[model samples]
Target: MQNAVLAKVPYGEEGCAEQHDSDLTAVIIDDCRPDLSLQRFALQANGRFKEIVEFNSPVRALEAFATKSLAADLILVDFRMPWMTGPEFILAYERLAASYKPTPHIVLLSAMPGAELKAYEINSRLLLAVCPKPVSLDTIETIVGKIQPDQ
Candidate 1:
């Protein structure tokens, strides 16, 4: 599974770009088979973002949930994952909200368009938007800009 997933993204050692220092931070959680190149491209094109934290595993992301609440201003979550789906993460996030010092904005993304409707039916408040993968940087930038105060 790991091999197949890595093949899909083909991770390379790109030198870390200088980190942007701003109050707003974004967290991106996706299944292993994401188009990371597209994600990076979108991020680069936006140019308004500060910091971004990415996780391939929902479990690992959950482990660092506390840290997210401390620093993140917004979170972008994929709808489908191996062990935990995006909506499930929101359920867990709701429970964890009691302990979160500051609540971060949450948005949902999916390759499937229907998932957005499902997410909306589940709870409109939990999800800010549902976007398809390979989404353009302009679209992502617009969405992020709306959510982040610093953007």
Candidate 2:
């Protein structure tokens, strides 16, 4: 369910989606529904992305990647998900052909502490960052700041 408080809040101009200037496609993968809704809202409010796609499972998200359906510019995935961890997903994603990989930034969101999180650090090429659970608007800004213009 979308947060009632956030529903009342307005974004940049009129509210909600306003055809973000960046025109970037952002994909969010999370097993939790409420968290997914909030993440979508945060990205919408940032006004940097054109489209936001949600996946409840990393496995389903991987399927999208394999089928060339998801051409994401920014990806936000939960680290601890059933079937595939975010790092594992990144590793599998890296196996796709060069033409299949369009995403420039991939963020892993986790509630796991530093030590445990370090164990999953595998790819620096595709995985751009690691963020905390319940991603806030500030976190969204920081992630967007990392995205370069050329990308």
Candidate 3:
């Protein structure tokens, strides 16, 4: 029953209506790793959304969000960025999207072990998942679980 209820939540690619940009539109925000490479990895992750945008800088990411259209189905933000931390980025993103009628899905990806604590300190519910470093194909599969509908 709980799973059924969770299926209706819009925390991921599942359970949500068809977005305007439904071709796996995603944003990869990572400073340490190569965005293009990570984007390709995400594409092969077998998720509902696709990787479309990649940003190595969190500040540029915020600018992209402000200047460009909010068409991304998911955002994979890395932790421990130079300009802004992952949590900070999320906070800023949330504030930026507050004006929007509905917020989009965001996934925080980090290699640091302490990233979890930061995520919990902020809005635990804002992030759909926290993917650790050394991401693998199998790990991606494991993380890309069944999408549940928004309750």
Regions of candidate 3 where Cα sits further than 4 Å from its true position? 1-22, 45-47, 99-102, 114-120, 146-151
- In the range 1-151, model 3's lDDT, one tens digit per residue, is 1101111112244333333333545566777546436544544445445434667777877876776554455667777778888889998887776654334566776666764456466574457777676556565555445333231
Candidate 1 Cα deviation (angstroms), residue 21: 8.0
RMSD in order of candidates: 5.3, 5.2, 10.7
Best-fitting candidate, scored by TM-score = 2
Give the C-alpha miss distance for residue 41 in model 1, angstroms: 2.9
Specify the poorest-scoring 10-residue window by lDDT in model 3. 1-10
Residue runs of model 1 more than 4 Å from their true location after superposition? 1-21, 67-70, 99-102, 115-120, 124-126, 148-151
Q: Which model, 1 or 3, shows the larger lDDT?
A: 1
Please report, as a residue range, the 10-residue window in candidate 2 with the lowest summed lDDT. Answer: 1-10
For model 2, residues 32-58, the per-residue Cα lDDT tens digits are 778888888888878887667788777
Extract clashing residue pairs from model 2: none
